[model samples]
Target: MASNIPSSAGRNRLAAPATPGAATTTTPSRRALSADPTSARLSASARRPGGAATPHARAAIRAIDQRRRTLFTPGRTRRRSLRDQRETPRDILRNLSRVLAPASQPLPSSSSSSPHRDANDNTLATVPEDDDDDFLIERPRFSLPLQEDEDDSDLKVPRSSGLEDENYTAHSIELPRRAWSEGPSRLGRESMASVRFSDYAGPEIQSDDVGIDSALFPPPAIEEEDSGNVMLGVGDSPERLDVEESRRQTLGRESLFGPIEIPDMGNETTFLMAPADSPTREATVIDAAVENDEPGVFDDMDDDHVNEPMDFPESDDEDNDNMEVPNDAENGNIEEPDATTLSKPMALATNRGKRRKLGKKISKHGIEYPSLPPGVVKRLATTFAKTSGVGKTKISADTLDVIMQATDWFFEQLGDDLSAYARHAGRKTIDESDMITLMRRQRQTSASTTPFSLAQRYLPRELLQELRMPVPVPIRASKKKSRAVDAEDDVDVT
Candidate 1:
């Protein structure tokens, strides 16, 4: 026989009819059976097998149920879109048509209908007969005198859709009427007065007190040609006229200080020298000699006349007598000695010759020095001696004098060198760059073993930058280091 089995045991049991109100024993689940020993013992007598469950499994089931409920929940807000926020062109056109439509259209008097009922009719009502009053309402606007070009832009319209057609017809038939009814202003008097001219016209505008009504002061009779040139008095001759015309036009007028007085220099006495002895030639020769390093060029020109005392005439009569030129034939040919010629030897000796005050302040050692203040020189000597590590040592007067002389010589040499550098650059004024250039050149010419050995210790930052030269990096503290090494060596030796 075939086995009697149900396809689904739980569903078949649920669907089966129950015997009337029978008392039933509670059935334990397989998990409950596994978890309790008493239930497990009782289930061992039963036919089916079962698996065990813990508290963690029940918690996982609860969490899964909560997630399912949350996933199915509805959103709090409705969806939004850009279309809802902006308008379409169709809507815009509709609004514009509504705004431009005529307020109402005239309707025929229907015997039974009210006027208010017809007033709410569509603006595109059927065209009625053209009555005179309706057409003449805007006739004043067209009858006005003013005429101007109207833009086609003002005349454009969409294809006569019902409302747009009515707006166009209304705008064309009833042009806006102006309320200004006054006549044009009376300006002819102002125009004529503005064109009239009087002699006193500007800030000098005259009061109407003179007897003449047209002008305060009547202008004198003056004649003019069409060329805008006025005719003055005629000249005696064409040449005289040309001269006067040129004289007026040449400088607008003559000199402000009357014609400048060019004195009679023709008779002035001038002593002319030969080209070889002229001042210009002498300067050129001196420059050439200096360039060639000639020591004798600077020597006294009149060696024999040097140290001679200058002699001036005792009286003005004697000077006048020397200056007077004798007209006698014998003496006329003989040239008198010029004062310049006579004084040149004295000038050369006084300027170029050696010290003449050699006996006044000469030391026993035969050294002659310039006059320097004793107190200042003494202080300088003390400072120098201290700086040189000769502390508290009394400087002898002769030594101070020597130091002063040496300092004076050093400053004089420096000034001369700076002047020579300025002259080489063809400038009379000495600038900061000249000094910097001289110092840089000096540094370059010297040996690389001594990099900081410049004539001047510091240069301006601007000059350094302009020259694209690096700022002077301080030399390594080699002096102190060397001194330290020396001290160490001395200690070792000791």
Candidate 2:
């Protein structure tokens, strides 16, 4: 019977292979004791002493047994499946709420909050779709306004303080130096003294209304005195008068001194004085006085005097005719001639020098044109001059040829117009416009031959005509009807 039981137990274990290995123990048949249900119960009762369990231990054992039952039973597995389904829906709702929630609310505090707390909180506070329409229409949240008093206080202090403390020191310093020490100052002083002396001597001297005295000197005493002896002192004795007159004349000469004398000619000690009969002496004296008044007179005179004989050989013979030469005098040691009273022949000679310079310049760049229309040549010359980048006085032969070619092309293109314009001007010439058109056509032709040129190839004559003519209004039916109505109204008004 035990062997059969063993076989049966083995078959049962094979049928239920999912049971724990510990539940299928192998023990010796000799030690095996089979007990009845009553004895089993008695043993269990003995283990519990009074057949009662302590509430605390009973609860603990019941909890452990419940957990085990839940782990093992298929029904408990079904309960776990239900729990998973419930958790999935909850997680989805939580994620949705989090995604839809406003960003401004403080992030849910992590301390006491569950991971899903923010989601739950957001869902509860979220407005429904129907409510949002009205909510969106409400005024948007704006930043808080700053106090006016605070802004005013900030602006006032610095501006008011700057205005109140406006006094600032500026220092300009100059170094000391001697005043009125130069030659100009000395001349000014001498002039003033001389003016004062003249004013004191003559009451008839001109005086300004401002009480400023102006000294006016009398003409030379020599012009008034026939004897050429005018006493400068009170003594009238012949010898004394002569000495005084001499002194006075010397002073006058010094007062009217001319430019500094030219350097002495080396080893030359000769004088050639103009004859008394000749007016050259008087002329020289007057010229010298006038030259003293003119600045830079000496520089001009030096060129003439230094090379006088070489530049003006004719002047030497004239000088000989006018002057009394001593046998001891050098050949070319002539006294300086008066610049102001230069003979008419000499003036003519100077003018001829200028004319010669002008003639040379003209020869270098003068343009000689064939007998064509007056303005035609001028216009051609002007155009070529402008295009050639050459001066008006120096247009080249090539430039002239270009101008002639341009003029010929212009006449061929605009012959009738050229004749009309020339007729109006009473001259037979194509003017500046003809030249311009020729240049423009040439540029166009050149540009057409070149790649990627911006120059206009053809004149837009039709487009230009259209632009000059006014645009006509389209005759629409509605516009015609309105115009008829307006005409009827005007007739009624009349």
Candidate 3:
């Protein structure tokens, strides 16, 4: 039976073939185990209770835990001293001792120093605690360049109490001296007290004698108009020479040309005078007209018959004289309807007046009804209220009617415009594309106009998008009236 039992190689031969469709997975068979020695070792290590993989995994987990611990851990900080944090108000008297007192000398102890010492003793340079509390000098930390060396143990001093002074080993350090502190220069001293006024004065006045000459300022000459002629013209026959003297005066100073005629100054008229000038006394006749006294046009006409009124005969067969007669009833049992009764209903529904009253009777004999249905207006009003976030508003009938009429007027104008646009496009029916195109054109043309701005607020979001890309819109066709039976049966429950 041991010889007949199947070996590992025989068991491998009995296993299923590795088809392409079957999943290719590694199985621990002796053949595979012999091919890869490392995988076999790994498998053997995983099977054992104390494996190398377990130790390595534990080490990796420890390293990750350590990293996480370090990342989340908070650091500890040392307590800060008062000097390191913020500098307080220092006692100037205590600091002055450090500057002025000798560094080599040790400070006298409180027990050694006598309390009843002289008032002027230099050892009593320390300020009393009460005085220290009353006055404190706050100096900026960075103001002084020199600082006491930290390593110098002999110069160190503790905080002063009431009367004890500590030894301060002051260093004998030289400070840089500025040149400006020496003295003022000679030039600077002179410039300090002097004022710099400009030497430039205004232009010199030119003397009249500078350009004046003999031609410009000549000696005065007197005109001698022969005294004899003056006396003879004045004394001899003054009346007879008046005309000649007047003519000579009128001629003015005689030039080479003859006497010049004085220009005429016409009569001055007031503002109230007619604009047309008076006709001239001398008439200029361009053409002579011959007037015939005899009457040839109406020689046989009588003067007595001129004032008589002409009589017009009244025509009885004119179109305006013919009146429309009422039609007589043809059926006696069922009387024919009156023309007024038949037309009253049709006339009432039509938009006759520019503004039709909401609840006015259009017919002389009919029931009064509102032009716009109240239910439709209420529906529109509720929708408006909901959109505007106005909770439960009461709209008056007149106000609603006015709003409806205004809306109707606006729609009518829009329809007219759309009709015009359709006609321009060579189509009687207006489409969505035409509406989008018209609105876009209106926005572009009248961007600054009021109408476009108002329309923009009311335009739909999709229509605004369509304005950019004039895409053909899919219009849903309205459903036709359903059958009474179908409608009744198809009614929704709630």
What's the distance in Å from true for residue 277, model 2? 48
Mark the regions of model 3 whose C-alpha exceeds 4 Å error after superposition. 1-374, 439-494
Question: Given candidate 3, what's the lDDT at residue 76?
Answer: 14
| Span of ten consecutive residues with least summed lDDT in model 2 | 360-369
lDDT of 3: 0.32
Q: What TM-scores do the predictions have?
A: 0.18, 0.12, 0.18
Per-residue lDDT for 319-424 in model 2, tens only?
3323323321345544433331235335545644543322210000111112244355666567656878755645465766555556544543454455555667
Candidate 1, residue 20: the lDDT equals: 12
lDDT of each: 0.33, 0.33, 0.32
- Alpha-carbon deviation at 280 in model 1, angstroms: 29
In angstroms, how far off is 73's CA in candidate 2? 99
Residue 293 CA displacement from its true place in model 2, Å: 63
